[model samples]
Structure formats: C-alpha cells, structure tokens
Target chain A: MKRRSNSDGKSVKAGRRGTAARKRRPLPTAARKRRHLRTAVRRRTASVGRRERRDQRLARELDDITEQQRATSAVLRLIGGSSGDLQPVFASILASAVRLCDAHTGVINRWDGEALQLIATHNMPPAYVELRKRSPYRPDQHSASGRMLATRAPIHIADLAADKTYLGGNPPTVAAVELAGVRTALAVPMWTEGKLVGSFTVGRLEVRPFTDKQMEIVQDFAAQAVIAVENTRLLTELRQRTDELRRSVGALQRERSNRLMNLEAMAAAISHEVRQPLASIAANCSAALRFLAHDPPNIEEVRAGLNRTVNDSHRASQVFDNIRALFGKADQGRQAVDLNGLARGVLDGLRGEIEDRGIIVELASAPDLPPIIGHRGQLQEVLINLVRNAIEAMDLMTDGRRTLKVRTERSAADKVSVTIEDSGPGIDPSQIKGIFEPFVTTKARGMGLGLALCRMIVERHAGQLSASPAQPRGSIFRVVLPAGRNAATDATG
Target chain B: MNGQPEPQPIVFVIDDDSALREALSSLFRSVGLQAKAFASTSEFLQMNLPEAPTCLVLDVRLPGLSGLDFQSELAKANIDIPIVFMTGHGDIPMTVRAMKAGAVEFLPKPFRDQDMLDAVQAGLDRDRSRRKNASDAAKLKATYDTLTAREQEVMRLVTAGLMNKQIAGKLGVSEITVKVHRGNAMRKMGAKSLAELVRMADALGVRRTMS
Candidate 1:
C-alpha cells in the first residue's frame, strides 16, 4: 500500500497532483503525468482486491469438488467389493445416497422389461417391504420416483403433499409412499446408454425439500446403481445358461444309454435267429454226403439234401436281413408275396428237420389263395418260425402221432389266412398269454425271441397273428393278413 | 485169418448226421465188411451188439451225447467196441480227449477215403484181436467147466507147479487119485503138456501163480 502511495506521489509531481514548490514556467507535461498517475494508482489497487477475492472463491469450489469425489469413491469402493453378489452392492448404493443426502429412506429398484422390481430398501416400513417381497412394481408415474423413471431425469419433490404428480397419477404409487410416511424425496433415473434401467430415490419423513446439493449427491450414486443392475443381470443370465446346459447333458446321457440297450437287444436277436439256419445247413451237408455214398447212388435223396442246402443258405441270409431291418438301418424290399408259395417254400426248407423228427407235415392250399403285400424276407421269417415251432412241438408227443398241418386259404372278406396246427403236447394255458414276449422260451437251447420276432414281423405288415387251442389235443397258430391293393389287383388279374 | 469159422467183421456206424452215417456204411460195405448204422448212442445201445469183430465209426458231436462221452459210457456198460471217431470241426483238445478215451481213430472231415478206410481197417484189426482173446477165453471156460471139482482142483494145483505128492496132500487124497484127476483135467482142457495146461488156466483167468 505504501509503495502505491509513493508511486502516486512521484506521478502527481510530474502531472495531476502537482506540487507548486518546483513548478516550471507553464510545463503542461506535469499535469498530464498527474492524470496518468491517478489512473495507474486506481487501476493497481482495483486489480489487487479482485485477485484476492478470486483466490478465496477458488478455495471454496475445491472443497465442494473434494467432498463430491469422496462420496463417489465411497460408493465405488462398496460396488467394487461386492461385484460377485449384487445385493450388498445395492444396499451400499442405497445407504450412500441416503446418508449423503441426509434422507430417512432410500430404495433401489431394478428394471426388468417394463416393470421395476424393488431389490433393496433402507429404512423401509414393514408393510412396504412385505409388498415388495410379494410383488413387482409396475410404475405409472404418479409418485416422485415414477416421474423420475418416466422422464429418465432426476425429479425433486420438496413436498409430496403439494405435488400435482402425487395427487393426479396412479393411486398405488402415491398410496405406497404415503403409507411409508415419505413427505419429501429426490429421485434420479439411472440408465445404460439411452435406455432407462431403473430409479434410485431418497425420501425424508419431513416436508423439507431436498437441497440442490443433496440432489447432486443422489445423482452421483445413481451410476453405481446402473452398474450394479447390469452386473446382477449378467450374473443371473449366466446361472440360467448353466442350468440349461446341465439339462441337455442329462438328456444326452439318457439317450446314449437307450441306444446301447437297443443295440444289445439287436445283437441277441441276431444270434438267436442265425443259429437255426446254420444248424440246418450243417445237417444237410452231412445228409448229402451220406446219400451220395450210398450203394448204386441214391440220387433222389442226394437231390433232396442239395435242395435243403440251398434253402438253408437262403434262410441264413434272411436272418441277417431281418436283423438289419429291426435296426431300421436298411430298407427292406416290399413285394406281393404269396402265402401259399411262401408256406410251401418254408416247408421245403425245413423238410429235413421235419422228416428227421418224424413229424408228418400235411400242406393244403386253396385254389385261389390271395397273396399279401409285405417284405418277403420278414414274411419268410414269420413262416419259418411258425413251422419250426410246430415241428418242435410235435417232437414232444410220444404217445400219439406227430402231425403238423400247415394250410393257407383266402377268406370271403378278401383276407388271406395261414394256419399251422400241430398235434403235440398242447401249450400250457398259462403260457399262451405271454408266449410272444421276448425271452419267453420253452426249449432248453433257445433264447425265446423267435415267436416275439415272428409276431413283430406279422404286425408290421398290418396282419394279425394269434394262437389258439386246436381240437384233438394240440395248439394252433394262425396268421391272417389283409390282401393289399396291389395283391388284390394281381389276384383279379 | 484164424482157421475157424468167424462171423463176418462188422463196422457199426453211429452218427447223428444221416449223410455221414450213410457214407460210412457204404464205404464199409464197399470194402466187403458188414455195416450197421445207428443215429445216436441210445439207438446203438438198443441193439444187441455183435459178438464178432466189431468196429464203431462214431461222430464226435451228436444231438444226445458227444462221441467221447459215449466212449466212456460204453466202458461203463462193459461193452468193448473199438471206436473210430469222425468230426467236422475237431480241435487238438478234442482229438487229445478222444484219443485218451481209447478211440482207435480220430478222423476229421472231410477225410480222404483212403484215410477213412485205413482207420476202419485198423479199428477192425484191433477188434479182431479183442475178439480172438474173448473167444479163446470162452473156449478155456468151456474146457474148464467139463472137469469135476476134484479134477479142477488138481488142475489148478498142477498149473501152479505143485508136485503130484503136494497136490495129493493139498487135495487130501492119495497120489494115484491125484494122478487120475490131473490126467482127466489135462485131457478136458486139451493141454498137450504142463506148460500148455498153465496157458489154458491163464486164458480162463483161473487162480494160478505168476508166470
């Protein structure tokens, strides 16, 4: 201050504040110097006051910024500690907003599609907490929080009792806040990108309006709320994805087990079906050798054995064909197969076995027996199983004659029927019911799948095969098939 | 080839395989031997087996019982029939098992005709020797049956190399009675000498000391 006073003294001597003790004769430069000195002194003093005041204002602004930073960091630290579990993160965010704004209540809701679901509440009434636990909140913009979410902006209702939004909007939003005794609140909308996620609201029981500073603190923690919502949403989706993966894995394991079991069943069927034809071929071979070596050559018997060999060889291939069909791996040939011709073929194939067992086979064919449309190999298997079963049945009858009667006829209803009647020890009445089940075998060396496979073949061709007690002490197996369109046309032709 | 009328050697063919049985029968008959065919062990057992030189050509596998098992079954029934086993799928263990059970031949099919004939011939030769021993035993039994109890005792003693005085002492009779009994026993047994009498007694399985 003294330096300014001195500089002003020197400038006035030269100009406006002129001293008469040293006045030159009419020197106008001193007056101008006096004017410049006054202007310079005024300007210097004014700038000093302005600079000191500005420094004081800057210090005050720094205090405000540091407090805001500390509050944000406090919320951020809480969010960082509980990213694994978002409930605590939400609780920390709510607590920071309520404490920072000095409010009595705080709530955090997560937006799921169109609804806000209350996940965390601080200082909540028992009634409001029970309501939130039981149901989700579908906001309709009646209360301060609802308006904030609708506008995707911060809403401050200094006094809810006088606010038009609380009075005119949805009743439940206002009713819920009134019941919880919230008289003042500041709600800020939280969002990720441009989409509104949810609202963070701090309420007070007093009718005091929230200060702009408190609203600023509330807005600060809103970011933490948005991040928490995103983290919790991602975590829930991950859990749901893992649950779906586990279910699919379980289904795959069950399907694998089922496939293996089916393979096991097919293998057993193949073994059981293949053994018969092989045994027949072996027998025919031996018989052929014997017949050829007979004295003077028994050419007739040799020819019979040779025919049996051909039949058995065909039967062996048919067994493999039937097994392949069972697995659905190969498409079997479907053709019009004559019941009479097929039965005669099976009988011829099993001629050696029948004769060896001393079973008298009587074959009768009607003049106009219609053919059935079906797979020839599968139908052959059906007839072969029945014929072999009849042969085996008659082999057990020692007291009476062993007779096997295989007959084919066309019924009046355009259906073809084949009946194999055996005069042997009749089937036990109890065994008749479950005789066609797989593994239901009577012979010691059998797997009991023959009749089951036979029934499957017949049924697949849309035919009915059944067993009944025959007159004069025996069992009879009958297979009736519908004469298909092609076969019926052929019959007319 | 013995200078005695023998029933023709028969080859019994027992196999479940009708062709193989027929083939074997034809082969045997072609070689001038009587052949009888049976389908199984039970069928073969039902017939009264021939007492002449008999050979059985059996299949190793059958519906009722296996050929090796049937071999033991024949032994259990006290029937001595030389068996020649034929198989379609014979392994070393089965061959070993068959041969160990006293099978005369183990021929696996499809055997050469000459090999089969040779096996049948060998089986027939074995059965012939067995028949010769059995017939000689029967003759010795017949000859031994004709002797009186005292003469039979004297013959046992004589074939045992007992002196006439010792035979008399053992028989509790006079030396002249012992001499008379020994002469009758020797004549009935058709023994030309003492060694011949010992041989006859051995054939009859009489109680004689070790040779």
Candidate 2:
C-alpha cells in the first residue's frame, strides 16, 4: 500500500515539477512530450497487472465448480448403479463429499428417529469407527452432528479443541479432538419429505473451517443421499404391489377356467339329451329298411317301423325345441312378482288334493320379502310344478305323517327366495344329481320335462333353483330370485 | 349244421326306451329270428329263458343297473349269456371295459342296420357254441355218473395218460383188474375207443379228480 502511494506521490510531484518547469521556462515542448509518454507507459503496466490477477482468480473459481460438479455426478452414478442398495451409495457420497470439501475423513450417520446409527465411514480413525460400531447412542449436544440436529441445519466448527464443549469434557468432542485428531468439523443434515433422516459429516485435521462453497457442496451430497433412500423405498413398494397384482390375476384366471368347465359340462349334457332321440330315429330307419328287405316283404311290419321312425324324428325335433326354449330370450313379458302370492295361488289351486291327501300345508311368508322381476306366468308355472311335485312326493308315504312347508323370505340383501319342503320318502342320494335333467323323473307318471323346464324358467329370471334333503325325512327345493334393480342395499349390511 | 333240428336263436332287447326296444325287436323279426323286448334288466330277469341259443342286446345306460353291472350279475348267477352292448355315447374306457367283460360287441347308437345284425349274429353264434359245449358236458356227466367207484377211478387215471400197470399200482389192484375196470368204464361212458373215453373224461372234468 505505501509503495503505491509513493508512486502516486511521485507522479504528482512530477506533474508539479512539469508545471514549474513550464512556468520557469517556456522553451521545452519536447521534454514535456517525453514526460507524458513515460506516465502513460507506467499506467498501462499497472492495468495489465490488475487484469492478470483477475483472470487467475476467475480460473481458480471455475476449477472449484468443475470439481464439485464432477464429484456430484460421480455420486449420482453410484446411486443409479446400486439399484436400491444404499450401502455403496452412502459410502460413495461420503467419500466424494469429504474430498470435495477438502476434509481429511468423513462419516454418514443415519438418524432412525431415535439415535445416531453410523452407516458409512471414509478414512476415519479405527478407534472412532469401533466406538461407533457398538451403539445406538445419541451424540452429545457438543458434537458436530448433535448441533446439526439441534439446529436442524449445517454446523461448521473451525477448531473443536477451542469449543466450550471441549473445555467441558464432552466425550464426543474430546474424542474428536484427541482420538480422530479432527480440528475443523462440518456437518450437514439430510432431509426427506420434511423429516431429518440422517447427517453427512466431514472433518479436517487442521484448524481451517470449510468455506461457504464447500458447505453448499456438502448439502448437495446430503440431498443426493436422501434421494437414494427415497428411491429404494419406492422401488420396494412397487415390487410388492406388482406381486399382489399377479396373485389377483392368477385367481381371476382360475375362476374363469372353472366357469368354462361348467359350460362344457352343460353342453355335454345337452348333446347327450339330443342324441337319445336321434339314435332311436336311426334305429327305426334301419329296422324299416330291414323289413322291406325281407324275403316276403312284410308290409305291415314295414308300416309299423316307418311310423316309429316318424315318431322318433318328431321326438328328436322336440328335444331341439325344448333346448331352444330353455336358452331362448323370454325377457319381453317381465314384471314385478310377489313370490308369496304366487305360492298361495298355486296352493289354492291344489287345495282339494291337499285336503284329500291329508297333507298339512304350512305357509310361512316374510312380510318384508322383496319383489322380483320375472315373467309372471313362467314363474307361476314353476311354483305350480314345484308344489305338485311336493304333493305327489308326500302322497307316496301311505302311512307316514304328510306335511308340506312353503316358505318365502328375503334370502339376501338383493335376493328373495321361495322354499317348498315335503315330508315323504326322500330322494335317493345317488339319483339327486340328475333330478333336474331332462327325461330324468322320480315320479312314475312324470314326463320328466317338468322339473327341467321349471329350472330353465327360473334361471332365465336371474334366479337359482337348488334341492337338498330336508330335516328328518323329506326333500326341500329352493328358488332364489334376484330382487329388482331398485332393491340394492349395502352389501356389508 | 347238426342233423337234429335247430331251435330258433332268440335275441332279447333290454332298453329303457320303448321305441328303440320295439324297433330292435322288429329288426330281429325281419330276419326270421325270435325277438323279445324288455324295458329294464329286472323285466328281462323275470322271464323264463328257454333252453336255446339266446343273445341279449342291452343298452349300456340302464335305469336300475348299468349294462356292465348286469353282465357281472349274470356271471355271478352262473347264467353265462352273450351281451351285445349298445350305448348312446360310449367312451373308450367303457368300450374297453365291456369288451374285457366278454361283451360280444359294443355298438354305439345310430349304428347301421348291417352292423347291428352282424353284432347280433356274432352274439348268437357265440351263445350257440357255448350252449353246445354245455349240453355236451352235461351229457358226458350223465354218462359218467353210471360208472362204479372203481371204474370211475380207472377212467380218471386213464384220462391222465396212465398205463394200465400204473393204474393198477395207483388203485392197489392187479393189472388185469385194472384193464377190466377201464373196459367197463369206457363202455358205460359210451366211448368207442381209449381216445374217446379220454375226451369224455375231459368233458366231465373227471381228469381233474385223478387224485
């Protein structure tokens, strides 16, 4: 500073001298021009020196920024390559942070809502690492990490030995000063979603506190650590959800296959039913042909065979018509039906027979039973058939007490049911499965189409018909119909 | 082809369907064979079966018992009869099982007339041969029953390929006595030669009693 001022003083003196010379002697224009040239050269040299100094400072700042960027990119690469494994990522982050901040060693401690768990360490003393290994201990308030937590911000201590905690014999501070030989310490907290998760701490062996730029770099590393932790947690959650979805899809596929199998069985049954009459037709045709080929050509026998063939053909076609009716669209004449009323009407029609058979008819109807949407006539046919079957079943008892139970109730929140129970000889357990099949009848005079047609009509109305052995000695038949659309209620209820 | 008269070969049709049963009966009648139709196995079982060649054309899916079960029931009752199985939908396992149980033919429904006739003919032919063998054995048994105890023993040993001397040692009698007994046994069994007597003993299963 004194040399620059002296130079200024010299220039001022020279200026005054030139003025005095100019006043003293008006003859020296060349000497004055030479003095002007000398002063211009000196000013040019001083400006060049200032420019060089500025350039050098700018280059140093650029180098620092480039190094910090390279370190950050390297840590990011580590996090990406680790693929949810945070151990190597934490280690890489601590190493890069310590190096970029110009510190000697570093430690990354995960705060698990309770205590400091030292997760990763880079170049730390063996004694300090051993001390950290045996613990879920909270750092004393004097330590760098403890202060970082308490303040919820970064802490920079230029000289740990001179801190009041060091004078007060804080164990971690004393340990940092004595065991780790750490003088200057910098600790930055890692935050994720507004919660402090961990701390990134670095210390130098010399009494040089980190620069603001270095503190910023350390904070960046802490943020990167938070991202890696968050990424791992999200990835794990994604995998678990994916597994659950796979299980649900598998269950749905199994259910679909079971339904397909049931459809196949139903088709097989239909084919069997159709084939019976077709076979009879073929046999009758063969018989007629054989009769025509007889030596005497039996004309009467041929006529009989031809007539049977016609009958069988008509029977086969009837089977097809029945199948069509079973699966056909009968939704045109649908209306709201009261099952209890339907049952009562059917019983009224059979009141004389019931009394003759000495059958005690019990009607138990729930007043709140919901109405169902169906073809009223078809549903009444079903009820009548079921009641007649129950009466016939009871009539065969001959000596036992005959009782008929007709019940109606809300089977479910969106369903209504009608049950017919008969006290008679129960169905043989083995023959129960085919009772609803066409041409399979337990009644001696039944054409066997009654129950099958009844079942089809019930199914077309979005209802289910099932049979089970009733209590003691009888059979129970139930028809469950879906309530109309407006009858929906909470399923949980 | 025997010189004696041939009784009519009857084909019994047992099926739950009345139309098919009647059609089958008509078909059999067209060929000049007696045909009887029954709606169930129990109905068929109640009839008096004549002493003639008879074949049963049974539906595989019967109301009371399956045709296969009927086959086993007939076997258990010692009523050996040829069964021609007819089914609306016969799977491979059912066909194989029926065939293994001595079914004459397992004809699926809607079979041609020629096939049904051929199956019934095969069944009748089998039953005819079986009946011929059974009657022949019964006749041989009647003839053999006329022999004395010593002659019967000699006949058994003779059918076992024993020489007269070996027969004498087995019976503890002289060789001359053995020859006498063999000659009388053959005479009673109506055997014209030793080979004929052995055949008669074989028919009566007398060789099996050669203890």
Candidate 3:
C-alpha cells in the first residue's frame, strides 16, 4: 500500500511539469524562473522520497529472506547430519518453530489417525507437557489448532479470552493452553503431498495477535519441521534394513565355512581310514607276484599271499562301506541284529589291524542274549570307530601290553550293553565327558569326528553310549541298547 | 677280495601294519634279500640282528616314536643304519625332512615293488660303503694303538710331511733312534711307503704337533 501511493504522487507531479513546459513560451522570465525553481524543489524531494522508500522495502525483504535462509539451512543440516534417532531432529524442529514465531512455547504433533500425538516440544514445562500427554488429542474444529487442521491453513488467535472456541467449549485443550499462560497462539498445518501429516503450534503469554508476516514466517518454519521428520523416518528405516542384511550375510558366511570344514574333515578321515587296507593290498599283490617269480616257486607262500590279498581287498571295501554309512546312508530298515555276531564280524574284518598294532583281544559275550533291533551297518561303524580309538590310545605304550577286551552281557533284565575296554593309557577323568563331541581328538592324524559320529548313531537307535576310565589303567566305552519292550520302541527285541 | 667271508645282505622292515609287514618279508625272501619284519621299533630292538650289509624299511608314522624321530635317535645312540622311509600318507615337507636326515628313499604306499627293491638296494649299498670306511679306519687305529709311545711319536712326525732329521730334532732323540722307530712303525702298520703311512695316519686321525 505505501509503495503504490508513492508512485501515484510522482505521476501527478509529472503531469503538472508537462503543462508548465507547454506554457513556457507565453510566460515572462521571472514567472518562468519561479516555476523552474519550484519544479527543481519538487523533483529533489521526490527523488529523495523514492530512494528512502526503496531502501525501506529492500530492508524488509532482506529480513524476510534471512529468516527463510536460516530456517532452510537448519532443515537441510538436520537432513544431512548424523541422526540415527529422530529425537534430536524433533527437538530442533520445535526450537526453530518457537524462535521463528517469537512465541514462548511450542509443540510438534504427529497425526496417528484420529488423534494428534505430541512428539516434541520446546520451552514446555515438564508438568505442562505431562498433563497434555495424559490423554489423546483429537483434532476437532472446536479449538484454534483443530480449525487449522480442518482447513489445511494457519490459525492465529490474538487473544484466547476473545476467541469463541475458548470462550465456551472443549475444556481440556483450552485448559491446557491456559495452563501455559497462553493469551495468543499460532497453529500452522503441515502437509506432505496434500496429506495432512501434523501441525506446528506456537503460544505467546501476552494478549497480542500475530501479524500476517509473522504467520507466514511460522508456516515456513513448519515446512522445515515436516522435512526433518520425514527425512529422519526414511533414514531410520534404511539403517534398519542395512542391519538386517548384514546379520543375514554373517549367518551365511558362518554356514559356508562350516560346510567347508566338514568337507576337509571327510577327506582327512578317508585318508586315515582307508590307507592301511590299500597298503596291505599292494603289499600282498607284490608278495604274490614275487613268490611266483622265484627259482623253485614257493607255492605255499604264494597261496598265503593270495589269500591275504583277498582278505585285504574285502576289508578295504568294508572300510568304504563304513565311511559311506557314516556320511549319508539312507535308512536301511532296522533289523534284529545279533550283538555277538556283529562284534565277531567286525573283529574278523580288523584281524590285520589288530595284529599290526600287536594288540591282544579278549571277547566275552554271555550266551542266549536277545538280539537288538538296529541298523546293522551303522552299529558296525560305531564299533569300528571305538576299536580304532582304543588301538591308537595304546600306541603310546612301549611296554607291549595292548589288550582290547570287548564284552557283551545283560546289564539289566530289560537292557543289554557291550563294554569295550582298552589296556592302553586310561582317559583323563575330566576329558571323558567331552570326548564324544565333534572335533575331540587324541591322535595327531585323527579326525575327531569318529567318536562324535558314534554317539550320534547310538542315540538315533534309542540307545546310550558312554565312556569311563578303567581302574588303575586304560579307558572303557559302553553302549547300552534297551531290550525292545521299552516305551520308545515297538519293534523286535 | 679278502680272506674273510662277506656277510649276507638283509632288509629290515618295521611297520605297524601286519599284512604289509608279512607281505614285504615274503617278497624280500622270494628275491633272496633275507628280509625280516617287525611290528614296532621296540620289537626290532629286542633282538640282535646279524652284522651284515643291511637297510631298514621304516614306516614314517609309527606308533610311539615316529620314524623320523627314530632316525635322530639312532644317530644319538651311535647306531649307523641307513633307512628307507615308507608311509601311507607322505607329504612333500615330510619327504624333504626325511631326505634331509639322510634317508635313502621316501616311498608313499602303493608304490611299485621294483621301487621298493631299488630303495632297499640303494640303502644296502650306502650301508656297505659306510661300514667299509668305518672298518678300514678301525683297523688302522688298532695298528696304530699297538706301537710303543716313542715309535708312535716318530711315525706321527714322519707322516706329517716332515724330514726324519727334523722329527728326531723335535723328539730330542738321535737321528739313528728316529730311524729305528720309523722302521718299526712302518713294519707294524704294514705301510710300505711314506705316502701310505700318511694315509693311514689320516684315517686313524693321528695328529702330530708342529714345531
């Protein structure tokens, strides 16, 4: 309004100058000099007035621009800064809103469907905030802020005492607003893509209405507030997604390494387990060939070599069968397996190994023992692994006393057990408990999975395998399989 | 070529695998190499084997003391036996380590029979040379030990690239006495020349003082 009036005054003065110029030839020199002086005075004042008015307008525009820049940079900083949590960002939004509106108290609300949620506040006394938070805030048209929410516009009240809503209505908000000693307040609606998200509210203690410029400035601050909240929400979500991805990757890495370790163990075990039989096969073959090539052929020795070769080949194949059973043998239906017969078969197959290690075996099985229903191949594997461990244990002894005593008997009326005892150095009492776990090894070249696999096989048969130190020397392994009348079984006994 | 009979050549095999041990013994016997197999090192050490040109086929991964450790132990006990190592699982580093310890061969299992025979033959040859050099030095030392002290001193000087007169001067004896000792020493040592005496002296490790 001031700028338009100033321009109108200049046009009227210009029209008077044009008429004076038209009558200049018909006038005397004195009259002409007076008009020129008067015109000079008028033009001088007009130029000064225009310069002063322009300077005033620029100053006001610069003030408004500076406020907008401050608010914008604050919001941009919140967006770019480290805000893993949005608490600090919320507080900053309220701080800017309160300061920009020149109000003593402020709040930022989040709309969670039918009610307003007060997320953050600045200069709000703890008691006052707690009181307002005691109940849900419904945005109704009865209150000034609610009116703004309904219209998607800013609502400024110069004096709450004169506002109609506060005069006679909704006691809670009016009371809450009054508790803060608020006489005037501004509530600006905040929107994101035309959806009403929340609002920024400011309250003054004095009874003075906010001007149009102050209302506009508060809206700008409200825009900055909405940006900070949305940015914080997106950033938090992204961080959570990244955290979940990293955890899954860590799990995958662990699984892959475990599989690789299991593969390496299988290879080492095959090498340690199968090499002995293969070696004997080669040796026997060479012996047989050499005997046949003799001057007077030693038919007797050659026959014995051929026989041993056959035995060794059979044993080598059995070694592979045992390893295969341990790896991934599909369940070959359980059968009534004679414990004594199985033990004898295993011992017969390992005759070369026992003799090689110079070990003496004492097998004592009670007669008329009931057969247990179990996987024959798997049970043989368990026995082999246990017997092998016993042999290796006795390898430390140089006194030439390597005795393996395997006994089977009815431990109870309903259960039978086989006890394999070694005359090698006894297991340490402390280590007996954990010796059956995977990767628990007593031999340098041994893959510790032998005993662990044995225990797993026994457990799967609804039986128990345990270890104990023998009296004064050696170690004992006992496998107890319940006679099939037990509750966990309905098969052959 | 000497009048004494050459001892028989034998192969000693020490392994914990019984079938392998038995087969190897039969194989060696078929070839007339006189092979003996033992289940363990202790079993081998229990009996006294013949003092013949012999080699040992040792399993590298034995029960108590490993074959490589047994090698160093043999050296410590002053047992001079050449060894050919056999293992079912032999790696490169193990082979290198065995070779470094003077092993004749490191054979991984399932090796060719000829390879075993070759390794045993090489081991036996190595032992033969070692024994020959040792016996020669022993014989020379025994002859040197039988000399009187003065004759021994004169022999030492004579074989040390010194003149007889200088030897006599150092021994504080007359030139004629030095000549008598040198003659007795050469006759007892059976060294027909001064160079032969010098070689015998070197073999016996007989040191003489320089004056």
Best by TM-score: 3
Each model's lDDT comes to 0.72, 0.77, 0.76
Judging by DockQ against the true structure, name the best candidate.
2
> What's the CA error at residue A142 for candidate 2, in Å?
21
TM-score of each prediction: 0.41, 0.57, 0.63
* TM-score, cand. 1: 0.41
Give the per-residue lDDT digits (tens) of candidate 3, residues A1-493. 2223122244466578679758635567898789779879977987798689668766766775687678668767876784756667767767766665566878788887688888887777777678668877785777776788888888878787678877765554565456677778888888898888888888888876665666766787788777877777788889999999999999999768645654554564566556766777777778778878777878998899889888878877876775776556525567788889988887897799799878999999889888888788778878877877777778768685789999999889988788889988777778777676433433223222356566666766778899998866998999998765561374433
lDDT of 2 at A489: 25
Q: Each model's DockQ? A: 0.05, 0.32, 0.26
- The residue pairs that clash in candidate 3, if any, are A158-A209, A426-A474
Question: Could you tell which candidate, 1 or 2, scores higher by DockQ?
Answer: 2
* Residue range A127-149, candidate 1, lDDT tens digits: 88777766666766565556677
Clashes of each: 5, 0, 2
Q: Which candidate, 2 or 3, has the higher TM-score?
A: 3
lDDT of 2 by residue, B1-211 (tens): 3488978889999987787788888777877789999976767887988888999998886753567878998999999889998876646788899999999999887777788889999999999999888787777777778889888888888888888998889778899999898889877777899888777777676784435
Q: For residues B30-76, write the lDDT of model 1, one tens digit per residue.
A: 55668899866667787997668888988775543457767988899
Q: List the candidates ranked by DockQ, beginning with the highest.
A: 2, 3, 1
